[model samples]
Target: MRCPYCGSLDTQVKDSRPTEDSSAIRRRRVCPDCGGRFTTFERVQLRELTVVKRSGRRTPFDRDKLARSIEVALRKRPVEPERVERLINGVVRQLESQGEGEITSEEIGSLVMEALKALDDVAYVRFASVYRNFTEAREFSALLDEISGDGREAAVDEAGGERD
Candidate 1:
């Protein structure tokens, strides 16, 4: 690596360690010419994925855009930041695992909906409303009904018996 301070080509790695999250490697380097030291981080980049819009336009997949959408839906919710990070990472992993060079916008929206649904019902509904383009009150009510029904079934299953 080139030395940042002295603009020299000779630099030696003094130390290397994994970052706190273990998602990247941090390297401490020193320039032999100027005796200057600096740090650099290295991260693995998966293959670039393309996003195919509804209008048939293809664009490079943007992780920040995906995270912003999820954050907007999760705003004011009781969820933790770590959970949000994990959700984003999970979605990205799932997309990458598909091994497709391109994925439709609809597919991404569906994945977000599924992740939000498991994270928070209110957030899920919020995202679904925008994602599904819900215009009628009945659409929301129907979704809420479905969510409530699922909750009831889960409760019943956990209780190990039907309601008396």
Candidate 2:
């Protein structure tokens, strides 16, 4: 490390400590020539992620955008904000675990749908309607059917009886 005051290459690390998040290391350095001290941080750099849009355009991965979409879909629902945040983190983790530089928006949407489905049906439908771009009423009916069918199966299994 170089001394900022005297521009001398005579700096030594005085202290080293891990950051609060444990994602990085914080180092304190002192310039022997000028007796000046400064701090530096070191962190593991991950490869940048690109998000491929539905239109085939590519952009940098954005966590806020993903979170905002989830928030909107879960609005007026029983879902918690922390749940949405965790879902976003889960989607991001899934993409990162692939170790790929670019991922399709469809993959991201699918992860979001899966996460939401495990949370609330209404929220899942809201997200699926926007993510899948549902146009016809039949599409919504199909979604309703899927949701209700799952409920029916669960109820029947619990009852251990045949449907009327």
Candidate 3:
């Protein structure tokens, strides 16, 4: 490693430790030439997932993009950042498990909407409004109806399968 202070190429790792969450390594390095010490962090990088749009255009999957959309949806809401991270992680895991090189943008949006639905209703509605392109009240109403219908179906199924 090169020293940032003196730009020396001769450097040795003095100490190494895991970061708070253990997601990365914090390494203390010393430059032998200038005797300058610095800290560096090492993290694992995952392969990019490709997203195929409805227009047949393919783009790389971006976690930041997903997070930004979530932020917009959960604006002025009670959702936590950790919850959003977990939701995004779950979607990424599901996509990776599929072992497919590319996934549709619609599929990705659906995954986010499903996760948001469980986290916050207002957030879910906001996300669905933008994702589903709600240009009219009817469009938003339709989405509400669909969600309500699904909930009613689930309740009925659970009631029928109840024990005792």
Candidate 4:
């Protein structure tokens, strides 16, 4: 690796370790000529994936774009950065595991909905409002009812008793 301090081509790795999240490898390097030290991180790029939009347009799958949307939904919530990273990783893994060159936007939205649901009910509702394109109060009420388990309780009451 080139030395950042002097732009020298003679740099040696002094130490290497995996980052806390295990998403990348951190390397400590030294420039022999200038005796300068610096750090660098390396991460693996598995493969390129494409997102097929609802309007039949295709674009490269962007992790940052996905993370930004989740962050917007999670704004002001008491969620940790680590948890958010894990959530994003989970969604990426799910998409990668599909092994398809292109995936539908609906599928991606469903994955995000599941992730947000497990993370926070409020965030889930927030994301669902935009993702599902809610226009009326009834739609929002239905989502709240579903998340609050009211729908399930009502179904059980209508059935006359709890399951044996």
Candidate 5:
């Protein structure tokens, strides 16, 4: 690993262990040049996956990007970071095991929504608002109703009623 302090390539691993969820290996490393210590978590990638954008653009899958998006949703919520990591790990595993190299953006969004809903309601709505492009407060109401088992169909009809 390159030293973040001095940009040196010589770094020694002092310790290694599996994370709590066993999804990644936690490594403590020290840079010989700058004597800087840092911890890195490494994960095994089953395969290189591609994300198919809605506009027909194909891009390499990014795990950090996925985590950032989820973190934004879980921001200020009571959800634990470990749970978030597990959620992200689960989504990545599911995508890799799908037997296909390319996955639609919609599929990823759906998986995130389902996972967030199970983890926390506020986080789910926060993610849904952006993933689903909620434009008004009523859209949120409809989603909240659906989540709360309060007649989603009726709520949607009322919220989505004539906006003119």
Candidate 6:
């Protein structure tokens, strides 16, 4: 590891352990040349991801951005914070496990929509409105109808009974 203080390439790791969430490893390091100590956190990344935009522009995948979008959709909602974390983690894991270096923005949007759909109806509709670019009242009505139908079907299936 490179020392942040002296810009030295030689740094000795003194301690390493998994973080509380086990999402990353915390490492303590010291630079021999400058006698500087610093901490670093690292995570196991299967591969770096590039997001391919519909406009033919490519950008690096950002987990924070994804979280922010989800937060925006879930804003002022009654969902628990822990469930939100799990939802974000689940989406990220699905992306990483795809084993592809490049993913489309549409694919990411779809994944978030699915996660939100299972978590909260309001949040799901909130996200879908923006994701699907609803430009008219009819569009909103169509989406609401689709959502209601899906909910009824899910309820019937979960009850182990035929749909009435």
1-164: candidate 5 lDDT, tens digit per residue: 89999999999999999999998999999999989999999999999999999889999999999999999999999988889999999999999999899999989998999999999999998988888777789888778878888544644332244232
Clashes of each: 0, 0, 0, 0, 0, 0
Cα RMSD, model 5: 3.1
lDDT of 1 by residue, 13-64 (tens): 9999986566668999999999999998775657789999988999999888
CA error at residue 163 for candidate 2, angstroms: 26
lDDT of each: 0.83, 0.76, 0.76, 0.84, 0.89, 0.85
- Give the candidate number with the greatest lDDT: 5
List model 3 lDDT by residue over 37-60, tens digit each. 899977553556899998899999
The TM-score leader among the candidates is 5
Better of 4 and 5 by TM-score: 5
Local accuracy of candidate 6 as per-residue lDDT tens digits, 35-85:
999999787777899999988899999988999999999999999887887
Cα distance off (Å), candidate 5, residue 161 = 8.9
lDDT of 4: 0.84
Give the poorly placed runs of model 3, Cα more than 4 Å off.
1-47, 149-164
Lowest summed-lDDT stretch of 10 residues in model 3? Answer: 155-164
lDDT of prediction 5: 0.89
TM-score of 6: 0.70
Candidate scoring better on lDDT of 1 and 5: 5
Lowest lDDT sum, 10 consecutive residues, model 1, at 153-162
Q: Which ten residues in a row have the lowest lDDT in candidate 5?
A: 155-164
Cand. 1 TM to true fold: 0.70
